[model samples]
Target: MIIRTAMAQINTTVGDLEGNKKIILSSIDSARSAGAGILLFPELTITGYPPEDLLLHTGFLRDNIRVLKEVEAYTTGSDTMVVVGFVDFSLEIYNAAAIIQNGEIKGVYRKMNLPNYSVFDERRYFTPGSRPLIIMSGSLKIGVNICEDIWVPAGPTNDQAIAGANLILNLSASPFTSTKNLTRMSLLQTRAMEYSCCMLYCNHVGGQDELVFDGRSTAIMPDGHRIVARSFEEDFLVIDIDTDQSTRYNLLEGKRKGYCKKAEVEEINVIIPQRKHQEFLPEETYRVSSEEDDLIDSLVLGLRDYTKKNGFKKVVLGLSGGMDSSLVAALAVKALGKENVIGVMMPSRITSDESKKDAVELAKNLGIETFEIPIESVFDSINGLMRPVFSDRTHDVTEENFQARIRGIILMGLSNKFGWLVLATGNKSEMATGYATLYGDMAGGLAILKDLYKTQIYRIAKRINEQTGTEIIPRNVFLKAPTAELREGQKDQDSLPPYEILDGILRLYIEESFSLDEIVSKGFDRETVEYVLRLLQRSEYKRKQGAPGIKVSKRAFGKDWRMPITNKYRD
Candidate 1:
């Protein structure tokens, strides 16, 4: 008999029980209509994944349990066995999964492993379960584990397989990083092969704060082969599994479980009258599948979710007609609607005519609103104020910083009056070398492009325009030599090395966490490396003050990265 399973890749918000319940019920109904015998959900699909500090509140945990009971009551008459993740409050709190068959909960599986390091903090909230849970269906014996359980080589799945489990279900809320799906598939396939059991792995999808869960749920045969895989986005995947003639089913173990349960306890035995058997052909189990879209989809989704969920109706950008700000404005328009984005052209005396003209043309091409705010007056006012303080010294970078501060205060005023979220457009190169002015251009409700390198920003911008068949980002921005335009002849190359050279070293030193001597030994000039390293070290405080952006890469300036501002040890 072929047992059909549906994996629901549902996106949930933390603490939104009513909404989560509606979604869960809808998915179960969908799966049932699709002829699925059982439906699987991700870890904490009810209260959402990584409820974080909310788990610390006792009332919150109580509410989670309350919803779980309500959901169990809602499913009493349904034939579909729905497996869902929740927080259970018994004598102690448990990260749990309830197996609901025909509207009543048959069994529950609490998560055994609690990840405490990196982005996970499950150990801080609840006590780990001591054992694996195996539920006895009419014909199929299913074992269950939570997110971090089967990722290990010697976890509960192994023990459950030893105890004669024919199939294993794993629920998770694994967040996306670089090449995470590849690693996940490898590990899950390894576990399936090692345990010789049909494995079903499900993960939640969507963005919650800085975290973006990539929902690539799948069902695998025992021989480390994929039966079917779910899509990355919100998907409802159903696959047929023939337990009797399935490739992964162990006949000896299935017969052994039919006779006994444990060493001492009585086996869970049920008497069902036999029905007439019909000749059967093996169901078609497809091989491994792949959905490889361009890398831009993830960046676009991450940006879109982060902006919309945060409740920002409109975004304001400081477009100097420069590469960074222009790319940012284009991305903002792409993420949010073009009408929702405003590009402000703030020009001082030092701003070139091409910069002003390009800004206007770019705004026109994108069909976004634009405003010209001349900062020459503000610069003159600030300079007049600081003239007496620096009576003897010639005009310097501090003078140029005044122009940026004026623009920042103006943006803040607009933000205050219009309730628009400001998107800071500083790139990783500028942010790394303290080349940016804190509380100046750095003041914003969100920093959309902070983590991206200068070269990467240019690349994504060009690719966007090329793909769209329109110049969303004008070509002039890319062609022009990058400049802060703070002074008359100030250029980026004059202050720092070219982005091609700088970001290359930065990729190894910052992102890869290479040591100073190690970076210097990679054929870079030692003095330049030392200077850039020092600048990066000193600019942690600047990064701390910048607005939080979507973490597209492995590490952004948000929660994923942590750097000390005051440190004594230096190379």
Candidate 2:
């Protein structure tokens, strides 16, 4: 028997029930026209994944069920079997996949495993399901499960296969980390090989607040042949598989008799017309994206969705002619389009001529609007006003921060005037060590590069220039000594250590969770490591007040890493 399956990797917005339903109905029509008998969508297709606190509202749940019924009605009179993720409520709520065929509800499979680690908090909202669900299409038995259910060793996948299921369908809304794609692919391949059944995985693509879902959905055959969809974008993948090859493993199925509970399984039978002499097309395999490519696309999508979904048509940011702000400008142009981005250069007396020139040139290169707002007069006025209160306190970091605050005021004023969202340009290295001034450079609706380190910032800038095949970001910006330019001849290294050493130490301390002794053993200076650690510990209050940014690492400063602002414990 041959079965054609379509994996709909779509982008969904949280709490947009009507919009999400429209997308689902449209995808079903597309799948049916492609001659696919079975169609699969990502987790929570009706209401979008991680609806978060919205799931707690009774009105939201009712609207979600209402939209699911609308989708089911749309699937009426079609031969295609639609499998979608939505919230199913009885005495309690459950993360569920509804099976619909010919206008009737077949069976709903509740997700057995509710993930509660890191970014996931499903257990707080959902009750774990105990029984497995199997739906039969002709002689082929296909099992359905949700995202976290397949990750367990002896979870629903094993039990479903043991109970004579030849295929498994997984619906997921897995978030993107730097190395998560590789790990996820390896796990899926292992499961396919272990169960000796064909597997289809569909994932959601788009950005939700701080989380980004890269929709690299995949189809794995029983013989270990894998086909992947696109990354960081929506894709409709259709593939034909041989069910006879998968059923041949039934001879070895008896080994799982003791482990399986056949009585607890809910089975539903449906008619599937066989296609004889059907032409099988070659599978398309997607190449894994490089770190730079993945980061750029992830940030672009995150920024695009955040701006558009929040009802903003334009974005504004300070163009400091430094690598961080320059990169932010380039990303803004890419995300919101050149016409929608505004670059404001706020130059003070201490700012370099080269910096101002580079800022103008970079804005011109990006085709974005530029405005020059010199702050020398404002700086002098603020100094004069504070002289009497300061008495004899000499110039220091406070004066430097005053310049930043002035620039912040100008950007925020422009934002208020034109209704454009401000994008902060501080990178992880600055935010980690409290080098950023709160309510100054940190003032914005969104932090574009909050999770990227200084070293990574330079690397991405170089990559952007290379990919664009032009010096969109000025080359001198890379070669020049990194600076805040708040004072004369000021460089980042004046206060912080070298970026190479600083980024390495931070990766170990922040992302890897390494101890001071362990990090020192890695050939870093003990004093430098301790100093950086102290700075990181003291900066919690600042980060807590900063705007949310995209998370591209294993441990982002946002929701993933929650530290108290007033902690005295030392590591």
> Which lDDT tens digits does candidate 1 get at residues 3-112?
67778888888888888999998997897677677789999988998888888788888888788888788767667778899988767788889887765777777788
How many angstroms is residue 102 displaced in model 2 relative to the true structure, after the best TM-score fit?
1.2
- List the candidate 2 regions with Cα displacement exceeding 4 Å: 249-263, 278-280
| For model 2, the run of ten residues with the poorest summed lDDT | 254-263
Q: Candidate 1 clashing pairs?
A: 75-103, 76-103
Tens digits of per-residue lDDT, candidate 2, 1-571, equal 7888899999988999989988999999998888888899999998887899898898999999999899888988888889999999978999999999888888899999999978889999999988988888667899999999899988889888887888899999999988789999999988887788889999999999999999999998766788898898899988887777676654455334455455368889876555664465455585777899899999999999999989999999999889999999999898889999999998888888899889989999999998988899999999999999999999999989999999999999999999999999999999999999999999999997999999999989999999999999999999999999888898999999999999999999888899999999999999999999999999999999999999999889988888999899887
C-alpha root-mean-square deviation, candidate 2? 1.8
Candidate 1's C-alpha runs over 4 A off are: 90-92, 223-232, 244-295
Best by TM-score: 2
